[model samples]
Every structure is written in structure tokens, then in C-alpha cells.
Target: MLGQPAQLLEREPYISFLSSSALVIKQWLLFDPMPESDARFLLVDLRQRLPVVSMNDGASFHIADGEPAVASDPAYDGSQPTLIPGQLVPTPVWDDRAGSCNWDAKAVLEVTLADCPPVSDERVRAAMELYVTSQYDFLPRSLYLAMLTVLDGLATGSKRADRIAKWIDEKVSEAEEFNDQSLLDGLRGLKNGSHAAGIRALVKRAVLYLGGSEQEAARQANTVKRLYRVRSQLSHQSDTVELDLARATQLTRLVLNAVVSNPALLNDDAGEEASLAGGRERRTQWIAEAEVAIRRAKPDCAAVEKAIRRPLIMGKNGLLIAHLADRTQWAIDDGGARPVSDEMASEWAALDESFGERL
Candidate 1:
């Protein structure tokens, strides 16, 4: 899989392999005994790109190398050229229907892969793998767990862990100093200030550290608390439960993007180490600088809105009727409807309600 033809762009500590086509993993092997040995896998990416035609009745056909061409077609002006092997290559289609000949759901990812920065931190990479898996994994329980795992891994820092450890040590010392055995009982089975408080703190800190406004951080921290409750319900009550996958996915991406775009944020441990060495102010200074750097990297919303506001389409009653000359040919090629009526609006409202119910 690593040896396949791909755009291998190397950055310090990591490399990204961007493929123009989808690569399906056929087989894989794990070297458990020899941990240092390289892992091996087989990928199935290369294929003959064939022309396919789909009818309105849902019937479809693909023209391969051995297939005969329709010679006497009314749509043709001249003799049709013979389709030999390797004459055409598969390209991404915008269709969303499953089992369609040109179904490429990862098309957006493919287009953005080249622009994505290479992850400098291994933990962030691991969290990103989990995030991607959560996108496709259909099991609600698994998806919820995977996203929460990412939060647990990246949201919490070494300083918080160290503080918790110190609190535990303090409790032990108080028990010894006062000869209170009940305090020792309180210490038993206690971890990280009761899971709820610990997790909420982690989420709050992570959001603020990533340049999110205080209100936004508090709002997301509240969201995590709700998710944690759902997690508990899933573990203790039943195998299945109602979950908000969208919210979980959004929070996961937020943290992952912040770290990937600014790898310096992942260097929180350096601050923790310095604080332990009696330079506590350095950690505070480092965090301020990191937040400023990340904010600078973020896109300007006003500029983005101005750029995208092109006079590309002609609209009627808030519906796009036709493309203007400024619109790209690709946008004009697709056939669609711009239904603008009272009945259409009613039906759209119904659809929106149904989608909200699902979420």
C-alpha cells in the first residue's frame, strides 16, 4: 500500500500520501512478535474506467473494453469511435445515491487532501484516525465511544493529570497527619475528581486553548457533559441508546483541526515540564502565543463570504433557476429543479422537521 503511486509529500515527523483514486484495502497482517517489523497490506485501487449510462427507470449499463458500441445511434452525428482498453479513466461524480456507477462519497476528502497539513503529533494522528472511522461506522455505540475516546486523549493535558496526582498525594498526607482512616476510604476507587468534573474541565480547557471564545468553550463543555451522560447510559443500561453523532463529530473535528493546523498546541507537555521545573510563567506565556497563532491561521469569515458571493446563478423566488455566464460549466451540466411554490415550501418544511427528528 505504501509503495503505490501517490503524491508523497513529506513534512518534518510525518508524511501524507494523497491518491487520486480510491484505494480499498484487501488484506492486512500484523507482526505481533516483532514490534519493529513493518506492517504489510494489499491495496486494490487500479481498475479499468468504463463509461456507464443510467436510465430514468433505474437501469444502468457500463461499456467495457469487450463491449460492442452502438453504431446506429440517433444522438451521434458521425461514426462512433471504437472504445479500446484504457481509453477512459474514472472521475468523481456528484451523485449521492448508493450503488451508483460513479458513487464517490469521499470526493470532498480527495479534493482537500493536497491542501491538508501533515500532522506533526502522533496522538493527533491517532485521534484523526478515530474521527475518520466514526464518520463511516454505522454502529451508534461504536461511534459515540470513538469520538469520546478522541476527546479523552486530546482534551486532557499532562498538567491536569499532574494536578490530579498531587491532589491524591495531598489526601494521603492528610490521612497520615490527622490519623483519619475515613479519609483513606474516600480515596479508594476515586479517580480524577469524579469523572464528570474531570471531563468537563478537560473539554473547557481544550476549547479555550484552541482559540475558541469563552462562551463557545463553555457551551461545548456543556455539550460534552451531556454526551458523557449518554455514554454512561449506553454502558450501564443497554447496548443501544439515542445519541447525537453530529455534535460529537463536530467537537472531534474542532480539536483535531486546531492541533493539526497548529502543532505547537500539542506541545502542552513542554509547558507542564517547565512548570514542574519552577518556570510556571513560561507555560502561561506559551499558551497565549499558541492561541494567537491559531487565531491567525483561521480564515477570515467576512473575506470568505465576499469571495463566495459570486453572480453565478439566476434566482427566482429564492430558488436558483439557471446559471449565469460567470458560473462554471460543471455547475451548469447537472440537471435539477428549482421548485418555487406553496406546496413545495410545505413539503420542504416537512422534510426539515423529519431531519431534525433524526438528529
Candidate 2:
């Protein structure tokens, strides 16, 4: 067992060294203090077994064990050495006889804090609203211009109705020109061509069916011509197209009404009542039927929304009716708006039934 004071002295080398140096100066003697009883016993046993010798300098005398006095000159001063505070001392050479000595110091510190929880429901709702707005409003507007160009092509038949029909036939024939390997590449090349041909065919058919009066045919033909001009400017001249939604809506209604009014266009029987009605009832019925069909299709809401939201849909070629339909659908869906309900569906079915089973 080691006493507390002895343990402190043994543990703190700086304090021990200072105390020993002070005692050597005052008493002119060396003292080795052992903290543990076992260490003291070993020291005493070693001293008893070893030989001791005395050496004298001019000022003081000292004893050493085992080793011979290498320097015994009286000229050596043995007075207390001056101690400089905080000065580093040179390390002594390692001696195998001294055995092993080691010193170590270690410390550790720790801290803890509470964790945070997740976000609230209100924030989630806000984020969803923002997502819907961007999809419906922003994305659709960007796509509207492309839609207009397609519509312009489809509407091109009113002016050059005859030429447009021939064009469609020719383009469809061109579609057959591609080999299996080149089909995709050839089809891509025929994009504008195919659209033009389709417009032509639509126009030719419209003209043939409605051309009984030259004046009426000419008016319809003029509309087709204007649409074609728009298409050409968009496709070849790099002209900017601005679709006037109001005008487009009016034109679409007119064309749809005309197509529906003329039962002869579809080879329906010219009944006395149909003749007496002067196509007015037929045109109204056609419009109603088309509206029902569109609702039934329930096209993409984004496409529909884009068309409705914008005053003018700009494109490279012109307005695209199909693209408008696409944008409208997008907008509707994005806004969380459902299409016509079950009631509307039932009503449309009844209307269709009144029109005839063929419709």
C-alpha cells in the first residue's frame, strides 16, 4: 500500500524533482523516497548487497553505489545547481538495468440533445396546390404553340379544298414508299406531308358535299385557304403564329355545325322534314353530338387547360386545334376538375339516341 502524500509525490515528477533538488542543496545528501512499502524493502535489500564508496569535492561530499568514481578532482564545484523555472531538461540515456517506465493521461466528454419531428399537414397541402398550378398553367401554355400548328393544317381545306384532297391521297401513297428498315425515318419525313394530305382530303370532302351553291363553297374555300396560308407561313417562313382563341372557337363551331347539318355529306336519306328544316336542326344536332363525343373522350386536361387559359396560342406554323384539346385536358386534370358527370353522360346518351343509332 502507498500513502496519499507519497503517491502524489511519485505521480507528479516536476514536484518530486523540485523537492529532491532543494533537499540536496540544504543537507548536502541524497534521499530516495519510496511511496510503497514493497519498493522501500527492495531498495534496502539492494543497498545491503551492493558496495558503497564516498567521493569528496572541495565544497561537498556524496556517496554512489556500484560504479567507480570516474572523476574525483577537487576542482569540481558541488554547490547547489541554479534551477530555472519552466526550463526543459535533456532526457537521460536508456539503461536496461533501470527496467521499463511509462506515463499516460486520458480524458473524455459527452453531450446529448432532443430530436426534431416531421412537417405539418398544411405545408403538404400547400405543396400539392403549387404542383397543380404549375402543371395546369405553366406547362400547358408552353405546349400550346405546337398545338396551333397542327390545327392550322387540319383547317387548311376550306381554301384549296380540291388540291388539299389530292395532296392527302398523294401523301398516303408516299407513306407506302418506305422499306421495313427505313419506315420510322420515312414516316418522320412525312409528318408535314401527312398532315397536309389529311387536310386536303377533309377539304375535298367538305367541298364536294357542300358545293351545291358556288357562293357557299367559295366562302368555305376561303376559310380553308386562309388556314393553309397560316400553315405555310409556320412551316416554311418561320413566321410566328398567334391563335386568337375567340376566333378559333367561332370557326370550330361553324365548321362542326356545317358538317353536322349536311346529312347528305354522310349519305343520309333526304327526308321531307330534313329538307323543310333547311339543315338548321341538323347543324345544331351535330354540334351537340360533337360536344358529347368530346366529353366522352375526356382528353388530357393539361392540353385543354392550356388552350382555355391562353388568349392566343402562338406557334411556328399556326393554331393547332388538336393541341388545344390536349392542353385543355391537361389544365382540367391539373386543376382537379373532373369531366362531364354521370348525369351529363346520361343526357348525351339520350341525345345520341334521338339523333339515330348510327351517330
Which candidate tops lDDT? 1
Find the 10 residues in a row with the least total lDDT in model 1: 305-314
How far residue 331's Cα lies from its native spot in candidate 2, in Å, is: 44
**Cα lDDT listed for each candidate:** 0.40, 0.30
Tens digit per residue, CA lDDT, model 2, 48-161: 211110000011112243422222232212232212122333221221222121311010000000011111233222322222222223333233333333334233322234
lDDT of model 2 at residue 170? Answer: 76
TM-score of 2: 0.22
Give the per-residue Cα lDDT of candidate 2 at 247: 35
lDDT of 1 by residue, 1-359 (tens): 12222221111221213322322221111112211112111111111111000111112211122322433322221121221223233221222223212333133123333234544466765676556544455567787789888877765423346667778777787778777788776664353345555456555444554433355457667888898888888879956678988677656665555455454444455422322332123234433333333235432211111011011111111222221133211111123322235564344334311011111
The per-prediction CA RMSD against the true structure, in angstroms, equals 17.9, 39.9
- List the candidate 1 regions with Cα displacement exceeding 4 Å: 1-111, 157-171, 174-198, 209-211, 263-359
